[model samples]
Target: IEERAADASTPRAGPIPPSQRSDMVGSAEGVTEMAFDASVLRERDFRDTRRRIQLLARLPDIVAGSVDDEELLVRVSDTLLRATPSASAVAIVRANVPEPMGAGDEKPSNEHPSKMKVLHYDCRENGAQQHSVSSRLVTTALQRRESVLHLWETERNGGIEFTAAENVDWAFCVPLRSEACAGWAIYVAGSRALGSNWKELADDSATLADRLGDDVKFAEVVGSLISGIRQTSHFQQRHLAMRRFFAPVVLDALSGQDPQSWLQPRQCDLSVMFCDLRGFSRTSEMQSDQLLLLLEQVSAALGVMTRHILDTGGVIGDFHGDAAMGFWGWPIELQLSDPHSDLSASAHVVASVLAAARAAAGIRMDYAMGQTEFRCGIGIASGSAVAGRIGTVDQVKVTAFGPVVNLASRLEGLTKHFGVEVLMDHASASALQAWLGQDEFTEEPSPFRLRKLGRVRVAGMKIPVDVYQLVVPSGGTQDLTDSQIDAYEQGWDEFAKGDWDSAYQRLLELPAWDRPKDVLLRLILQHHRIAPSGWEGVLDFPK
Candidate 1:
């Protein structure tokens, strides 16, 4: 055995064997030339690059289903710590989390709430290099608006102790931008094993940074996803909070759209509807001991009105105690028949009429069974009105201006006098008729039945408006028959034509259930069965 080993250990005199030849070359048949991208970055598929890429590719899929903020942070931090060989520990801090809408900006006496901050961390319990993250690194990255690479054992990481390990001991910080947030950033640190040469790695920090570029970009992309999810959640939270103040249509129109362009004061043909609870004063007096219960009932009734208004795509303009005002035709979301036509003008009034009638009928049919009495009087008027925010900077509210708004409120008052739940001005009544005349407008028999109450001048306005009862065929209020409608119209025409005695007699012949005619009967008797000179049948209400 010793003699054979001595012979085998002897050096060869020359490299004459084919297997021992030094010449080595690639075959050109099936190969293509590819150059290194050193000018931009050193292109190499080494361990760290490939591992980070794999982690990045799998990242979005991992965090894609995470909807909650804390849950998302957990998924991202945990995935980075576990998947990336270089990461000793990972920390993602969502800085300056935005306040949810309304964010409890309530009165001082009210109980205010605070929003929770989102912070998540993941660490390997190997008790080695990457146990805790450095705060200096995070601040520096945010200040520079870029990712930063630092050695773990540095004077910059003061007060926090770190033990440099043989495997992975480096820190990375990547700053991120998020919509609707104060600030967002991610901190990933640790080393993957190739060889741990701390001095050489520090000297070649630039190249190391280039190698970590994909990981930096991955952190940013995840940060962006977190930001987007947070923003969407922010919007949803605001949408729900503002539902107390705004209708869904209003919120939908304003969402992702410029509020300055939509809410700026503008002149438009507006159809305004005003609704008020009828027996609120009486009910409040009777239920004063149980005010909370009465308040809940009022809220429920307003909810019905708001639902109807929003269902018709109307803007809920304002709420005055037991009253709510809704309007359309601001040109924001109006779909006009003609491109040059006034936004929603005449046609929109017909829709407003429908919504107002529906709201009144809904109150009587749906709310009458509740313990709280809910009888609403709704008035609809259509004309030019300037619509927009009508308040100071400290306090603002959406409302409309112009004579039409006042007229609608007055018509609402007239519902009590006329024994009707809904009423509309001449403009709205005419538009309803015109819309009903069009074959395409209504496919079913309209629940709305209109009967003229002749011209009447309410307090605070000189011009007498042609009043019409918006009779719902199945409302909680009186449902007039065809004969009753004919009788009312016959007397109204006679009254409009200046035949007071004959008109008064026919109106008296109608049943007392036709309470709308009672006002006419009293007016004729006010003038002693004779038409007063210059009295053109305008029943002026004394204030």
Candidate 2:
């Protein structure tokens, strides 16, 4: 066995072989001629070059809004091959990994196959590699980033080697990054048997790669833009919700309602109250930051009061900076069996509102100016009035438009004239008399004065309206009356008739003592029905 092995390794010397000499000479001449031809060929085929450019230019427009990655790859590969006829096969690897060398161990050749082969290699994993061979001349072009060209020759060992093996011949690998999570690598292989110049073909392949990359970049930008748009939409939605929570009245105006019809022509019984902070303007002017702090405290106090009012079934009409207006009977009504019952409810509402305002004022004074104290004046009235959406479409407001609202404001102003924290008109005072508990008022009552105008008439009266200043603590009052309860039920009936204007007017007229405002909202809601299209439902007013 040792002797045999030695003989196998030993070189065998023989006589001059004519056949081998002829073959060697012929191959050398052929290679030299081929090299000359390759050198003379230009960088790229002019016709094919133009076609590829045109195809690449269209890629961006085609790929937009497309979700199918495979379809995108296939279309891109087809465009590339058509643009450059020398390309024997195009393989697109849509993954981060290196591409596999062959299709299932099938050895690739430098000769062009009978048909062009296009393969889609899906490499979902991180490391996937792919390899393909086209014409030998083009193979040498696969070096650096873009293009390569090559020439193949068979050796005595029955193995094949490429010309200019030092540099990769005939290969183009272009990396692609998209908006999606994965990246792609496009591979184009040239054939040596086709007898084409690989250098020119390689350059063309490089150009193709660049064009495809641009397409990928465009797609990525589009995806990012879409994401940004969605984020903006979400932010807008949240903003609207916050606005609605803070200002329900403002929101209602924007929600589409006819201002003139809703506000101008309707009558209902209602309880109205006006509250204003004392010395707020002067304090705010002195220190703006301090004022803001004061405002925040005031807002918190108002929030608590508003919640209380809502819990007791009252509707807040409007708030103007430091001032706020609330109503009981306009939008809803209460059922009051007795006149005294009506008076009791009004007393409670007025007391509750004034107490809340004072609490808020005190808090603001304590936090903003330790020694400084704050106070608020409130006025209460019960009467018939109209309230609804008012103003032009571009600038609309939900407002109570009636003498009752004016009277309430006038009474609030009278708080300064009368030198008292709270004052109620004779109507409201009478309605709330029972609910005032043990609190008393001075018998020598001054006339209720009006702002701009001097005096005004009130409901259920034959003489001038007499106003009373309640001598109650910051926060004390009685429950509602039976007549006020009757008023709430009547107000609700009007609200259900799709007559918000009349409902509000009649509800306001019911008596402050009725606690008409506290129970009015609930009654209105109970009796009122909203149509599917959001219109107010018809009311069956009881006779």
Candidate 3:
């Protein structure tokens, strides 16, 4: 019966197939002589044909409203009931399907067929009966995977009527099957004798069910795609927020790794650089108009330094008044325990800061009584430290915590005492030396010149640390000459060997602008008289 109903459907461009049409007409040839009235059949056919036209006109609306699944299903149920002749109730139930099968999969078991969730539309006074009958019809249609029609007459109070639900005498249950969904659509109508139109009604109901199934499946697919799109959009927004707080390398690593794990504190080897304006405090005491101009110049200088740091894949940790702190090898394993990477990063940072310092020194503002020679100091240190995010949720910062951070800051402060513009610890200096040693062209003059200073124990440390000055030749702005560097090194060797008088004479032979020579002169004057015992020239800061 289901197959015949399916075959009855013809393309809108042509009439039904001749053979099936002839068979249907021949089966109803003797309708007038049957037990049931023929007029009832004729009237049913007329009404069903009209209702089908109405349903077809509204089919597009039902399909187009598929963005909202619940709304679309409700409208579909209502339309089915309207098109079904004399229907007292209608129900639509979606099938519960397991995962899609693969080629090698065996047939799935139906022992625990999914429960039916029926959407019922009750037109009669009895809602409970409508629901109960709908459930049974849905289950039957799913079990058979076909259309099921039942007709019965109940003798109640001398009148024949169906007694199962609202005295319905006829029930039509058809499975809604499509590539995207499986379900059932059930229609129940009151008792009426139909001599010939019963078969036609069943065929029409089956056709409608099949076509509607495809539409519903398409709607479901569209809805699922929309949901997935929304979820992806949300994830992208969160990723952008993470980018705001973390460096690009860290963000890339976190993109593949877990963000929660990356946020936790960990011990890592890092290179930290601290840069501060040398005379910002004194400059700040000037009149507001002049102070504003000076600050603007300072900002421009920092911008240049910032580009250098970022270009070398460094992360700007934070900014203090007139100063900036940045670091490398964090959030992700940037340097990866490689000394060369640390040295390269530190060298770049020092070069950038020195360039900014040089630019600041030439600031010519009318308010400057003349050209204001602004000087800056950059201090770099490389070692292991604890790195991660810190502070409350509302105001968090990504930075490192350890002696490396402290020593870097202290080194920046010492740049003034040593009369040098750029200073770094032994680790950075050694790494730079190793990196420079790899250079094949020794005659071309190395890109950077490294000068070792005497050992010094800063205010907070128990052991002394060796410091070095980094100098880069600006564009035609002549750095230390080779001869001058040689002389300074020889003098420094003398000073380290405890020959203060010889060191002073050798240092005096170099240019007076040399910062190391200035530092050695100061040290000699301070310790010439009170010679402390076992003093190996390790300068200690006063508490």
Candidate 4:
């Protein structure tokens, strides 16, 4: 009786084809019910979905921290693959530029290798080929800016008819976009079992992409903030250095030293010089790889020159990229019995830097040869300027803020317009009159070109001030005597004419000990700005 009852209670239909299903026992009863509770199933599904979303959300932050493009792509692909288990592969393709208004845009990475592993295509070697599902998905996402899902029924033979029918059952493509940029495309693919969950996974993946996009935006903001902070800090530091040089007593107090030594500032005689490099931006553009390297070399040479200045009792106020500014006098002014002796020192500094520039240019030739060259124009002005610590304890800055410093900078700028290498104002020329002695100097008429100083007006002062150029002869051993130096200057002229070979040849003739060699090397290396072989001798270029 029990066996008969059991047989009657059991459903008659087993797992069978849909066409063969029995109608008598009712269709619903034919299939076995899932043992799990609906609530538990729902909770598990929600948790899984959240986990997937959370993983995708963190991807952009991770990618942004990557040092280079290759790492960025790899990180993106890995994150997407982990999110969707059915995904056999994932890929991201980026567009070079945004689509124009009312026009169809083409994918920049359409030729990239697919990320799929099942397809026996060597993507790493041959790049993203047609047989790769990952490649197609990346391309599609980049073009559509939307998610595309393809299943086995829709895409067979790895999306190629001639290839063997390899099963890539499902694929999901999602576009990643950042402000003003189309970042990449994320793609995932897997087998039929994975294909069953394709729609749901696609929804989850798209959500993840949105989250990652937000992270990218945040990273950019943070990066910009950091850069701004760095610039501000650098400016403040320069101000502090100037203060320390001019007013030791004030600097001591700011650093928590004795306040008793504070005394009223007095007018002091000083020599101010401004050195500016020409064509720095153009040089940077021409030698993109070696730009940083060149900057470092120039900075190092400047560092050496600065040391020379300090040794000679000169106070360096500020050093900006391709610019060095300093003065003598104030805090403690140089006392010269001859009075004309300061002129020799000023000339020495200019000559030393010129030598350093030549050496730098030579070093660059060893790396990239005659690609680029550098030239610097210097202006010197000697007069009285107030020097003191000009800020509160927390924000104190030592600076020589007066008309003399401004005049020096103006003279430096005027050098280019006048076709002169070194220019000096009337006061500096008079101060160095004894040293000039009709041998190493030339006096040119002041071409009074009026200059606008923003809003302030100087009564009777013209834009271009009276300036004199130094005309040192060739083979002079005092400081500016070297064939290599001449070669450096000639090379710069050739470079300006787009005669790279001639420039390189002239630069190559410069001796190893030449100062301009260093400057020329930096200019040439700017073409292929590779990372320095080691961290030694690196210096920051002025902006």
Candidate 1 off by > 4 Å: 1-50, 57-67, 78-173, 187-199, 238-266, 330-345, 367-372, 386-391, 395-402, 439-447, 475-478, 486-499, 530-537
Q: List the candidates' TM-scores in order.
A: 0.68, 0.34, 0.53, 0.33
Report the C-alpha lDDT of model 4 over 146-252, residue by residue, as the tens digit: 44443223222224332223334344444444432334444444443343434443323233322223322222223233234434444556447544343343244
The lDDT per prediction is: 0.66, 0.44, 0.56, 0.45
Error of 4 at 7 (Å): 90
Off by over 4 Å in 3: 1-254, 287-296, 335-374, 392-394, 439-443, 475-478, 527-530
Best by TM-score: 1
Candidate 1 pairs with clashing backbones: 86-192, 88-190, 168-191
> Candidate 3 has what TM-score?
0.53
The candidate that wins on lDDT is 1
Between candidates 2 and 3, the lDDT winner = 3
- Relative to the unseen true structure, what is the C-alpha lDDT of residue 43 in candidate 2, on a scale of 0 to 100? 29
- List the RMSD of every prediction in angstroms: 15.0, 24.8, 15.4, 23.5
lDDT score of residue 381 within candidate 3: 85
lDDT digits (tens) for residues 344-446 of candidate 3: 4444434333343343333322114443435577888888888777678698777778998888888888888877767889987776676666645366767
Candidate 2 lDDT score at position 364: 45
Q: Report the lDDT of model 2 for residue 65.
A: 34
